[model samples]
Target: MDPVRNPYSPGAGRQPAALVGRDAPRSSWRVALERIERGRSSQPFVLYGLRGVGKTVLLSNFRRAAAERGWITAQVEAGAGKSLRESLGETLHAPLADLARPSAGRRLLIALRTALSFKASYDANGIWNFGLEAASAPGGGADTGVLETDLRKLVHDLAAAAEEEGVGLAILIDEAQDLAEEELVAICAIAHAAAQDEWRVLFAFAGLPSLPRVLAEAKSYAERFLYERIEELHGDAASEALTDPAASENVRWEPSAVKLIVEESAGYPYFLQQFGQDTWNAALEAAITYDDARVGAAAGRATLDNGFFRARWDRATPSEKNYLRAMADDGDAGSSSGTIAARLGRKPASFGPLRANLIAKGLVYAPEHGIVAFTVPGMAGFIARQPSTD
Candidate 1:
């Protein structure tokens, strides 16, 4: 087996060789795109899950699918210290530029002018030359210094331009939970109006498990948004995620070996790819064996410890580490805020800042009212393996 030809990819937001166990969401997305193309409105899709559960990967897939259909697509991530306006403005430039021409439609010219105004909203010193005369066009009020007013105008004009081109507009946001309150409200408001007015635009958001609650808190109408909770693959889907990639490389996995890796990885997509890669490297024969799987699982766990889990663990302060250590007692199911405080021999209110810090660092998230869990899977075991800092 050659490591150079390895088909498994195990990085943050990396698309795997074989993307399994996501047919439902993919099919829904296709239908939504078709509906928008037919002048029918569709609800926004909200994908919420733990880290490494493939939310970003799936969102990327959605962007690709829309782009393939000639939809005006912009995919962005929040919480990178940039506002939604800035991120969206930057990402939309390339596609819009590709669509710009001298004979562009009236609506397209208007959209270009609106986009220029949106760009100016964030970067006063910067400008976009779409190589078209959009100055005399009708639309340019998106630089009002108000998030809702500006975003609505931009999306409306762009959606109209998309419809004129016989396509649709798609806007996707990853890490939606990190978006500012005003940003979230503006997005939800525009999406709601889009649906009511039958605008040819589609929206998708992906983030941690708390994303649904965050959206609902931002706008009560978000309750009606289509929410898909991504989780680990199960049974046959999990097996296929590993086997299909190996098969494509003309390699085979013994049933026992596949079962061992699948069970050990707990059907998580990231863990499966990691274990699969290690097993491929460990296999000396054309076919993977159970013994190779054992060695690979060990290697994969070490890699995750030194890389995935350890990176997040090291980001915590000593106080935050103690708080995490206390939460580990509850395993990956999450821990009560009061319980963690009690374990640390402090009042719940006193530990509020610690919990908030962990959440802000994306290491932990509140799944419910008072229960907080790791954003990454298997984090409890990783924390338990760490040497005591106290």
Candidate 2:
């Protein structure tokens, strides 16, 4: 017997290529990359949104498109304390090495080593060696301050080399928000240098809402450019996401199920995937058409309960869970911290732990000062539907 397909892609980031509901954004990105390849400055793009908004997948698509355009592409996921220069340099090296060519390879090698000299371990012989140690060292003998210069030269030389070989150069950076402070400044410097020299360095970045802030904090010039935000779907796009793919696969989604998803997801991509997964399971368990009644019936069934919702549900702390339910009950007239304190029957500051915990879980955010709300639109509704223990 074949196993049932898991439609709920809670792990959206793990499958970048099979992303759904992002065609418009992908097309826009392709256009941006095309401009960069033609020696025009592509807008430095930042795909910002809350967690599970498909920002990561969209950025990966941009990277893939850059490669197809004969551009040398490299990708690195940024994190605190990680050397963005070394990561960028490592990814850029393969194509750069390929481009290094007869005598240029030797010169580039010397230059790379010199640029990276601060890290004494990155010797000439050690550059090409594959191991954890080489990858960790500062890239090439270039001073970190002149990372902009070294990277600009790397791209220019690589483009020249690629042009000779009938190719071009592109760079993809993910999680741009997590970059170390100095590394981020260096990256902006490189972007400015690329623009000044008209070098063929193309970058596509995706991260949490803070990413644009980080870029601007690094260099205000980033503000002069336009960055596209990949928002949740609505209206026709949501309908298409629900119906088009299912219809093509010869599977029919009950109109009610689709509507339920739209209402529950509030058009958020992650919730869309979650609702879709749930509806599919609902259809399977009943051996009946997946209509509103069947889905409603399935809601109480343990099979569906133990599915996507429970997975996310189980991950939340008791206090965070309590906080969510409190929000749901408070309705549109949001609860005051004092009101919440009274209802929860605890010290005013006692809710502090739960509030901060919920925010950290990414389940809620402060839309205004002292006013926190669920990060997902349908979250309140779902919480409302659950049994209230307190």
- Pick by TM-score: which candidate is best? 1
Query: What TM-score would every model get versus the actual structure?
Result: 0.99, 0.69
Return the lDDT, model 1, position 70.
97
Residue-by-residue lDDT tens digits, candidate 2, 1-390: 011543345455654213566777788777766665566766566787766667777777777787776666777888734577667666665654544444443334443444344233323354353212333323353544555555555555555444444444666677776777776786777777666666655666776665676688789887855577777787867756656645644566666667766775667666566556556555644221447424633543333346434555666877777766767777633456666677778877877877876655556655545676554444555566667662
Which regions of candidate 1 fall more than 4 Å away from where they truly are? none
TM-score (C-alpha) between model 1 and the true structure: 0.99
- Output the lDDT of residue 276, model 1: 93
Off by over 4 Å in 2: 1-8, 14-23, 93-126, 129-140, 143-166, 285-288, 292-390
Task: Give the per-residue lDDT digits (tens) of candidate 1, residues 135-169.
Answer: 99899999999999999999999999999999999
Q: Which residue pairs collide, candidate 1?
A: none
